[model samples]
Target: MQYLKRYLLICIAFICILLGIIGIVLPLLPTTPFFILALACFARSSQRFHQQLLNSPYVGPILADWEADKRIDKQRKKQIMLMIVCSFAVSIWLLQAQFHLQLLLIVIMFILLFCIKRIAEK
Candidate 1:
């Protein structure tokens, strides 16, 4: 049972790492969250994989900082917020939604942005 769980975790970690790599080239698919998940799974299942992930130039620093402090830098936070806003705006504009729904989405996005900004300031 333990072995099975480890195998499953390794598989999921590999898949997430692959997705994170793909997300690097695909603007619509954000990479950080997937990389974070991969790190978690690798930490639990395979030390070799975890070390390799930490050695990755693109993702290593973010993972290291997150692991050490549970915090992201202000610049990264701003970048992430901008990406989220632009993506949401594009989605809202492209969808043929009702005015009220669009307004609601904008409001939600504003709230999220505000929260993220507050966190980043800290």
Candidate 2:
């Protein structure tokens, strides 16, 4: 049962990592949340994987900081906000013919911004 559980967690972790990567290209999917989930899973299933994730140059420090204090640095927060805005803007512009979808995207963008704003800064 323990082995099965570990296997399951490892699988879930990989899926989360994949989704996190995809989220980089598709802004609506979100990146950090998935990576965070992956980190949690790896922490439980494999210490090596957990350490590797923590050592990732791109997200490593951010994840490590989050794990330690659950806060993001001001500069990183600003970059995230900018990325969200730019991606949503491009998406909305591309879907100009679909007014309802555009409204939906706008709503989602605001919601994402609000959620990000709520996170405590480091």
Candidate 1 overall lDDT versus native = 0.80
For candidate 1, which ten residues in a row score worst on lDDT?
Answer: 113-122
**Candidate 2 TM-score, C-alpha based:** 0.97
Please, what are the lDDT tens digits per residue for candidate 1 over residues 1-122? 99999999999998998898886665445678788899999999999999898888878988888767768898889887887788768766866557886777778778767766665332
Task: State each model's CA lDDT, in order.
Answer: 0.80, 0.95
- Supply the TM-score for candidate 1: 0.71
Top candidate, metric lDDT: 2
Q: After superposition, how far is residue 83 of candidate 2 from its true place, in Å?
A: 0.4
| Candidate 2 lDDT score at position 62 | 83
